[model samples]
Target chain A: MPHLAVNNLRAKYGALEVLKGVSFSIEKGQVVALVGPSGSGKSTVLRTLVGLTPVTGGNVTIHDDKIDYASSGSLRRARDQMAIVFQQYNLFQNMRIIDNVTVAPVKIKKRPKDEARADAERLLAMVGLADKLNAFPDQLSGGQQQRVAIARALALHPEILLLDEVTSALDPELVNEVLDSIRQLAKDGMTMILVSHEMAFVREVADKVVFMDGGSVVEEGLPEVLFDAPKTDRAREFFGKILRH
Target chain B: MERILEQIPRFFTADNMALLLQSAGLTLAMTVAGCVIGFGLAFVLVYLRQTPGRWALPLRVICVAYVEVFRRIPFIVVIYLVLFFIQTVASNASLFTIAVISICIYAIAYTAEIIRGGLESVPLTQMEAARAMNFGRLRTLVTITLPQAWPVILPPAIAFAVSFIKDTALVSQIGVFELTFRGKELNNQGYSGILVFGTIAMCYFLMSFPLSMLGQYLEKRLATPRSEQSARKIRRT
Candidate 1:
């Protein structure tokens, strides 16, 4: 069975429906990249999965356990199993980098403080930020902040990670550092669903590319198949436009 | 000028000075009681006002209407209303309690706006990040939102309370024996109007100056994020 399955998922922002019966699935250890133009609801799918967006219709399951968005217990369970990194990094401006990574584990998960701190140190070092643990979010470069955000999410020990345009806000020169951290995660068999506009990074790291347009999946397959020879005209046009430059 | 000089000795007599001291202390007491309690209730008001969903629609409307109505009413009118309302209900509520209730009602309306603005100033993404981590709404508020919001909230909140040190003079209309009421009594007793009122003004200044200085110190202290402060502490150590 797939580790996660989204069937006919629907969500809306007030009067406008952003995710119109979108469906996809991710097996354990597979990285699925959701790529599309702006406002295509690619990020909304990730938001809905984490219960940020109210899921208006349909269902999502992890490890074959269905999530009932209306039930707080179920939604909380889903959130505990999945973590999302946002485009803006959204680190707690009040917290040092070390606290940012360890806050949830120690405070919410009720782990011992020393254990959380040690894990935070390990994760921060993994993301190439061991020395800057005491720095504030504003003190770091955008790429460094995003890497810290990743470490923060990892400290939660989520079963599946979600990346919503993680590197979209970075300067071009700073993009590689974050991408390198994600690439290293992918190599270690971590499952992630990423929404990205960086076609090359998506091509490099995504195990399967799911092409989305107008609030639904247009085409999805292996990265080579989907990128080189999309079955849908919409996907072909989108890839043609973005990949051209 | 000679009349004023002679009135100074009379105005500064032990009995009169004691009355002024007592009145000034009363003024400070009511302002602190009213503002601190009101500031806390304003947090509850803002939280209730932000409650989402159709079920909470009426609650949100009530919260918003309370802020709007209280803010639009004059402070003196609120004092009279609270005084009469409390008298009708209990018939024995102290004048000090009535004064505090009036100031609290006024402070809640104004500080609620200040607090709501401060909470909104923290980006929505911060709350979202907390929510995704299974942090409950209240925990997200206390742990995440409130910490970041303190800098934005404190300066304006302290300013409101200090300005309110003067506004509470209106509470004297109901015979609270506070600064203004005592000043009026002293003036009525054949003292120089200039001496009595001028001394009263100095008392007001004396109370507000230290409080505003404290406000400035707090603003500067909290404006530096705890992360940076800890880093500095590490370097010093």
Candidate 2:
């Protein structure tokens, strides 16, 4: 059985169904990338998994435990197992960098402040932001702030990390600093579901690439197969268009 | 002019000065107590108003109605309603309490919108980040949302409170011994209108000017760049 299975998951924003029976599975320690054109609902899958978007139909199972989105307790448990870094690097603007990383761990997880701070320092160091511990989010560059967001997510000790177009909002020159941090996480064998437009980065890090369009999966396979030689016309056209740059 | 000049000496008497001082204190107390309580309660109202379920529709409606209805009604009308409503329930409730309640009711309505706007000014992504980390609603609010919202909320909130100090005169209609009521009382006692009211005006100015200055200071402080604040902190040490 897969470690985490999203079987025919569905969601909607009012009458517009965004995730029409999307299904995928992730084994432990594997990096999966969700790639597609804008508004193809690539991000919605991660959102539904974390309960940010309400799951209108279907379910997710982790180790065969079907997540009940209706129950706050179940959702909390699911959230505890996964942490998502947003595309905008939504660091709490009120907090300093160290506080941003340690807040969830200390406040929500009820972990010891000392241990959480130590782990936070380690995570910041890992993301190459050790000297920026006291700085506010607005004080840093976009790439630095994005790295802090990644460190913030890592401090939670989540089994699965969701990166929702983490570098999509960065300057071209600033993009690699963030991707480099994610590359380090990938090297450490962190389980992550990445939604990205960077075809090269996706190919470099993704164990499997799930290509979605019009709110459902069109094709998914090893990154090599999907990128070098796509199966479907849609996948071929998407890769062909995006890869030309 | 001669009449006013003669009355100025009488008005400057220690007894009259004491009364005016006391009245000014009462006005400040009414504004601070009412607006502080009301501002706090507005958070609860905004929270209820944003409840996201079909079952909470009535709750959302009720919260919305409270803000809408109270905000639309004049402050003086709210004063009278609260004055009479409380009198019916507990006749012994002091006029000061009644006046505070009136101002609080009005403040809650006005500040609810201010607070809601401030909270909304924070991008939805901040809350989403907090939610994905398993931060409960109240925790996210207290820990994340409210702190970030302070910059947007405070200047306007303080402005309301400072302005509401003048509005507290309307409560004197129910015979609260606030500045305006006391001014009227002194005028009724044959003190010149210009003399008594001019002093009362001075008292109101004394009360609100400092508060407005504090509000401005806070606005500047909250808007200061974080780097500057850190530099100041380091310099202070």
- For all candidates in order, state the fraction of native interface contacts they contain: 0.77, 0.97
lDDT (C-alpha, whole model) for all candidates: 0.94, 0.93
Q: Chain A of model 2, TM-score against the native?
A: 0.98
Compute the TM-score of each model's chain A versus the native chain A and list the values: 0.99, 0.98
**What would the per-residue lDDT of candidate 1 be over residues A1-245, giving only the tens digit for each residue?**
99999999999999999999999999999999999989999999999999999999999999999999999999999999999999999999888899999989988899999999999999999999999998889889999999999999999999999999999999999999999999999999999999998888888989899988889989899998998898889988988887876
- Highest-DockQ candidate: 2
Clashing pairs in 1: none
**Candidate 2 lDDT tens digits, B1-237:** 999887787779999989988988898999999999999898889998988879999999999999989988988899889988998999999999999888889999999999999999998999999999998888888999999899999999999999999999998899999999999999999999988888889888988899999999999999998889988998999
Error of 2 at B2 (Å): 2.2
Task: Please write out the lDDT profile of model 2 over residues A14-69, one tens digit for every residue.
Answer: 99999999999999999999999989999999999999999999899988899999
Q: Please identify model 1 stretches exceeding 4 Å from their true place.
A: B220-237
lDDT for predicted candidate 2 compared with the true structure: 0.93
Binned by DockQ into CAPRI classes (incorrect, acceptable, medium, high), candidate 1 is medium
Judge candidate 1 at residue B61 and give its lDDT: 93
Compute DockQ for each candidate against the true complex.
0.67, 0.87
